[model samples]
Target: MTRIFSLTCLYILFLLSSCSIINWEVEPDNLKITYQDEELSEIFHDHILRFIDEAEKRDMTFRSGKVNIKWGPELANHVNATTFSNGIIKVNPSSVKINHDHLSLQLISHELYHLLCQPPSAYDHRSRHLISGTPYVSSLMVASSKKGEFPTIDNVEMWEYYFDELFLHHGDYSFVYDYESNSK
Candidate 1:
């Protein structure tokens, strides 16, 4: 029993220490938006703002800083509508203009969540964009627990993203709360 307890304590200590390395802390209010093509700027900005409002309603504070939004010819030909903590969200304008049944919003919203709260590792992030987002989603719970993330922002965001991602998958738009209900 003593040996097992000692081993458990050591493992816990190691887990706690490792968590600090993978976390990329960025304030939610520091997010910024800049447009490569001035024309599509407003459109993308509106979408981003909509996401922010939705997140806030859920008590998530993803920042509102100056994020560089690249689209149109300025957008990379082979980019996957990426979002980074560096305040940049790049998307193909063609995809936005012809969203093909509102798929673009789904894609952008997913990336927005990624930017708002990053995955634990670069590899995990890459894997998330693949055809199978489920595997990665399941991994979030285990990975976060392994890292021993306590009551931190990263931990909270991880939970929020986990549930939100699931909600996104089922085409549910009931996340927004009724403000008037609070008055009652």
Candidate 2:
């Protein structure tokens, strides 16, 4: 059974990878590290902890018990970071360009916030009309930062409107949160 399950997982991963809209390549080891100065790392760590604590207060659980952050210079400027269901968040090592010491800690929190408050499924919920009924908890992160504000609550509310229109004819909300969507 274990062998069968492993093979099944591999097959599913292959399918998902092929269907992914974001095409990201793995970074080489030598270029994979972003060495932040002591001060910046400390500051970034504080923010990250705060984000996690806030989520916990709301009874939210991360897809992965631990969030993994990595930095590599090969990433493009447009690419801030991407969060996978498996709990990996990769940031551009050279994101600050000149000031590597000032890592985008809020940006890191923003991405993790997305993971913590993901719509439960990959199916775009942007069309749901639930409005106040469907809230994106991460929106609160916005109030804390000017640069890496989490997705606006208004944006999420609009997403609810669109989701309902597309998925359900009525305003009834029906669906299961899919945490296994990216399970390996």
Candidate 3:
């Protein structure tokens, strides 16, 4: 029966991976993990805790109580990591399986940066959102980079987009770019 249950779970995970939208599950302690995987479940939990530790060590304020971390095959193809401004981080399990401290730290810092900047709403109704927040949390990391608060990503287009929003939110200033001119 155990073998059959495990097989059934694997099959469900297989189906989820092929879906257009990833499914999220609520675990104990109000923690949210993306997708389902019996094999990688423990490892995912450990990494979330470890990422929070690393974030705190770096002086980053990461509120794990309100964030969803996804490290299962539900991630889009060829994607290593991605985050929603509202506090969902999608990562590839293979990216964290190894003990590469640098990669792990960078990714953790990046996601934690999102949680700190935008501030996620806790799942237990511990907090409330006055307004709908922004999307594309990665771009906000780029905004922080402009102020030397976070690391800059290599994606120029995304970086430019976030900078525009941040400045507009700050003061009466705007910057425009000719994408066609820079495309080449």
Question: Which tens-of-lDDT digit does each residue in 50-102 have in candidate 2?
Answer: 45544444444443344556564566776656666765666665555224212
Ten-residue region with minimum lDDT total, candidate 1: 141-150
Model 3 segments more than 4 A misplaced: 1-35, 38-41, 54-64, 71-78, 93-102, 118-184
RMSD of each: 14.1, 13.8, 15.9
Clash totals, every prediction: 10, 13, 0
> Which pairs in model 1 have colliding backbones?
28-63, 29-63, 31-65, 31-66, 32-65, 32-66, 32-67, 33-66, 33-67, 34-67
Candidate 2's displacement at residue 69, Å, is: 1.1
Please list the residue runs of candidate 2 whose C-alpha ends up more than 4 Å from where it truly belongs after superposition.
1-40, 97-105, 119-184
TM-score ranking of the models:
1, 2, 3
Top candidate, metric lDDT = 1
Cα error, candidate 2, residue 139 (Å): 4.6
The whole-model lDDT of each prediction reads 0.47, 0.43, 0.43
For model 3, residues 1-184, the per-residue Cα lDDT tens digits are 9999999999999888876352232222444455445543443455456444433444443344456656546775455566676666666765542244333434544554455434445211111111112222322323222122222345446444434433233222222233223444
TM-score per candidate, in order?
Answer: 0.45, 0.41, 0.33
Better of 1 and 3 by lDDT: 1
lDDT of 3: 0.43
